[model samples]
Target: MSKIVILGAGHAGGSAAGFLKQYGFEGEIVLAGAEQIPPYQRPPLSKAWLKGETNENALQLRSSEFYAENNIDLRLGIAATAIDRTAKMVAFDDGTVEPYDYLVIATGSRARKLPLPGGDDDLLLELRTIPDAERLKQALGGGKRLAVIGGGYVGLEAAASARALGAEAVVIERMDRVLQRVASSTLSEFFTRRHTREGVIIRTGAEVVAVSGHSVTFADGEVLEAHAVLVGIGATANDELALQCGLECAEGIVVDLDARTSDTAIFAIGDVTRRPLPHYDVMHRLESVPNALEQAKRVACAITGRPAPQDEVPWFWSDQYDCKLQIAGLPFGASAQVVRGDSDTGSFAVFHLKDDRIVCVEAVNAAHSFMFGKQAIAKSSRVDAATLADESIPIKETLL
Candidate 1:
């Protein structure tokens, strides 16, 4: 009987173990995780969880009984120390060694911390784990003030949650506009207006020189004092184990479409992999839950000798206050953009077209537009910009 050992009990690792069992793989499965708790959803850590709208039980991916009933060896609170590729064995920090026929690395990503002079890094709060969320939640309340360092999705979501909790929030972004790296200028402007309307102060073109205690100093000789400081800049892929084992790595651990790494017996998945996109020639490291689940399925299929799952267009979603932003596909090589609805009413979609084919769509509080764009991108359907812009015409009619 083949035995599979999975590292890092995040969404990808836990889902991979479950998929293998569901696909009738009679192998010995061992899922190891450094955290004491079972796999849980991370998306809500900055929003619903932080706002006290959801509890820890609701965030779990599966109950503890599910693992035992499935006959999976679920090892928690144990970290993998090393991997011996030749012998196909994984060493744990608890001084135990597990032999495996196939190994899966799903070690997700970690929050990136900003190093500042005279700044106590320990005082800077982050929302990557449950413990981190608890700390941040405790710091926010009726009269508390939160100073967010980054203006990305996580930072903005936390700000919105803080406002919902009757706390003051001020977002300081180093870029000229918020969400400049991931979103278009139109989106930045829309979110900026929305956040400002909610009484959240947004500082664009602002650079933080140093942070001391609850005080943040800007390069322009401006200082802002707050009750708490949050660093939500970004995340770095946890590829140290793969790198130590001599796997091919770029921005992340390099993997094929089947989630197989440079070594045929070893597979990598989730936020730790730099995988090839479906339609594009470039490789991307996606951090969304959908991406993690897709890769998990891919690894399971590959190991179980089943047919590969169909490629899916990458998508992401963010909830801020009463607004929902759903994005489909990457806007790479797009030449034109069309607005489907009115932005003033807070229900709109931006369609990005490349050579008349729909490449990407950013829908705000518009589910139909998001669904249409996702299907269109999957089918590589061509669309007319003029028809897409005309709200009078139906979205289906705009497709060519």
Candidate 2:
């Protein structure tokens, strides 16, 4: 029987293992993870789970019984020490070695820390793992003061959750606007106003110079006090494993459409992989669950001698203070943008167009628009900007 060993055991690793069995691969499958817990969802770590609306049980992707019943050797709380490509073996930290015909790397990513002075203070926390969420959750309660560093999705979501818990949340962003790297100015302004209304103080263009305990000093000589500091800058891909094994790696492990790394024996998935976009020729390292699941399915099919699944149009969603924000496609080269609804009412969708074709959609509290926009972008459908911008017309009708 062929032996397939998967590292990470996060969403991508776990899904690949389950799908391998479903595809009738009677191979010996081993899933190893650094976390003590079973494969669970990470999206809720900053939102629902942090708010105490759900427990660890709800976070699990598969039950402990499922792994046993499926004949999967699930190893938890164990880290893969190194990969020996020549020997086709993986060395574990516990001095155990696992030989495999195929190896999949789904190591995911770690939360990036701030580089400013005193950024490593104990009170400065990052939310990437369950333990990180637990620590942040404890601080969220009792109406404590929260100073969030960074204006990305993680930081914004943390601020929203803190405010929901009756905490005084102050978001300090160095950029001129929050989400400046990923979102448009209009969308950023909308979220800023929304957060402001929720009693969350948003300070854009404010650079942090130092962090000491619960105090954050800005470059502009402004100091902010908080019970705890949450750093949600971004994440760094876990690509050291690939680099150590002589795989071509940039910001992430470079993978082809087949999810194969430079070493064909090894494949990569999840946030750790830098893959080519479906339509665009450029490589993108997506951190969303949809991207992870899609790559997992694709890798499974390829391993089972089946046709690889078609590359999907990447989509992601976030919930903050009763607002559901759904984004579709990558808008890196967007030339035009159309607003479909009122931003003041906190319900709108920003349609990004390139060469008269829909490329991306940023929908806030607009599900129907997001669904249609996602499909339209996937199909490379072209629509008139006037029609797309018209709220009077249904998004479904706007599809070309």
Candidate whose lDDT is highest: 1
1-400: candidate 2 lDDT, tens digit per residue: 8899999999999999998988888889999999998899988988998788898888898888999898899999899989999999999998899999999999999988778789778778998888889999888865599999899888889888888888999998988999999998889998898899999899988978899669899877978888999888889999998899899999999999888999888999999999999766689899989999988888889899988887688899988888899999889689999999998888999988997788899999988888888888778888988888898887767766
TM-score of 2: 0.97
Minimal lDDT window, size 10, model 2: 391-400
Deviating ranges (above 4 Å) for candidate 1 = 118-120
Give residue 380's error in model 1 in angstroms: 0.9
Per-residue accuracy of model 1 over 1-400 as CA lDDT, tens digit each: 9999999898899999989999988878999999988999999999988888898889988998988998889999999989999999999999999999999999999888687774556888888888889999998989999999999999999999999999999999999999999988888899999999999999998889998648799988888999999988889999999899999999799999999999999999999999999876679999999999999999999999899999999999999988999999999998988888988899999998899898899999999999999999999998889999998998899888
Q: What does each candidate score in C-alpha RMSD?
A: 1.1, 1.2
Q: Please identify model 2 stretches exceeding 4 Å from their true place.
A: none
